[model samples]
Target: MNRDTLKNWQSRIDALSLRERAFLLLTAGLILGYFLYLLLIQPTWQALHQGRAELESLQTRLTALEIRSRDLASGRATPEQERLDRIAALQTQLAERESRLQARLGGILAPQQAAQLLQSILAQTRGLQLRQLHSHAGAPLFNRGSAATAAGPAVGRYNLTLEMEGGYDATRRFLQQVEQLPWTLFWDSLEYEVKDHPDAMIKLNLYTLGHS
Candidate 1:
């Protein structure tokens, strides 16, 4: 039937014992308490747990930041440490420069070895006649004993002189080969004169540096 009619019938019941009424009331109270826990107390408990977790995470981050700040305040590098760092940086730069120099310098060789290479290169030139070839080791560019500590390396200069007879094109090719040698060579002086009809005489002075 209608809800009002059911309520009226329930109210008309008057045969319940006091113990039965007490049990019914206790059961109603327990049911109401369960509903209250589900609607309110459980949500509150979960919110508290979530807030505690968030607080712990924030505390951990704050502790790390505090330690970093303390280190920044008291762990500044000393002058000696800065000096050592600068020296290390300079050494690294020097190493890179040295590598580049070696590449450009080609190969390191003694004066005699460089002269032999040059002689071989000249011998390969077609339509060119070699009159004379000479090579000699010269003095160092600077006094190594006094400047050794200040300079990076000791370099000694070597001299080479050549006299040849050939056409201009052949002589140019010969010079190009010398320039393309595996070791570094520097041109000091070059003199050429038209001798007879088709041939010319050339005198060349070249300098090279070697590390000691």
Candidate 2:
């Protein structure tokens, strides 16, 4: 049956006009081309487009990395510049510390000032019977030659001996007031004797910095 059908169709095609045959051939070619485009050509074109887009993205990333690398190279600091920056920072810190030291020194007392202050303290101690009071000259604890020169400042220690007779409460109040002074005072020794009247002998060392 299939062979008969093919023979009939072939006879019909053989009887067709040449123009009609050419038209049919053209139509079949167009259909074959369309199928080929759908199966192979369209897929290849889409793949190529996607590949081009990916390549463009990769190129953009590469370009950005190159720019960053160049910037880093240009902005890199030399070792000498880094060292200079550190030195400047250290100098600033040193200046600040010196300022603080000067401020602290301002609160201290000089030899003459300390003598006057001690006199004032003695006057303020009410109900304190003075036995003896002695004040020695101040001497530098550091280099004597540098202290004589006006390069910076020098630290000095002054000795003071205070002997007084008073009750326990009055002596304690006096000591508290002495402690509240702005200057730094060091208690070297203290001797006390209890009898009908209590008496106290105290030796103190005072520290001061020379501004002159």
Candidate 3:
């Protein structure tokens, strides 16, 4: 059903006037751009806010507990030995929490490695001309601390946007190859314009997450 629908749309697009095709492409681009912003950016912002809240909550709670411990220690009302034991117990609790909080999330895809992989894939796709490539930093979903001290945790998603010009088959093959890559790539937006006939312009925005 989807393939037939796509064929129908392709035929319809092929039959449209150049100006109408351009307008359609523009509309599609706008829609896809908005979709990408919602998919890639909004979720990250939400996760970041949640992560900050969680970390801050943890921090505040620990602070409050430490302050209380100190107050009990400074007050002669509590025995020194008991206060020391309480402080030691709190330190152990903190260590255990930190160790558990660093739980592994998922696979890691380094920014440099991702870029290199993209370049290699594009090179293999004959007749595809890479026009532009851009990178964006990722926001951590949660804090990832030392692997030595605690369990290795997952990192954030690193983003890349690429623009290329190629024949339909080449562009299609390139996209397919990217999909086959081992990394966890999220295809946020894809804009393929065929106004110029056999050769088309393609804009691709994708993000890959880091490892465990």
Residue ranges of candidate 2 with Cα displaced over 4 Å: 1-103, 144-153, 198-212
TM-score of each: 0.46, 0.42, 0.45
**lDDT per residue (tens digit) for residues 1-212 in model 2:** 69999999899989999999999889999999999999999999999999999999999999988877776699755567667777666656555554455567666676567666766776788866666667775665444232133334545566677677766776777778878987766667766666555544434444445443
lDDT of 3 by residue, 1-212 (tens): 69999999899999999999999999999999999989998999999999999999999999988988887777733567667777666656655554454343234456668888898899988989899999877785444334322534445567899999989899989989987766557789999998588888899998876633
For all candidates in order, the CA lDDT equals 0.76, 0.68, 0.77
Residue pairs of candidate 2 with colliding backbone atoms: none
- Report the lDDT tens digits of candidate 1 across residue range 1-212: 99999888677544567887788889999999999999999999999999999999999999988877775678655567667777766756655554455454546556667678877877898878879988877886554332242446656688889899998998899988877766667889999899985799999998877665
Instruction: Report lDDT (Cα) of residue 113, candidate 3.
Output: 80
Deviation from native of the Cα of residue 18 in model 1, angstroms = 99
Each candidate's number of clashing pairs is 0, 0, 5
**lDDT computed for candidate 2:** 0.68
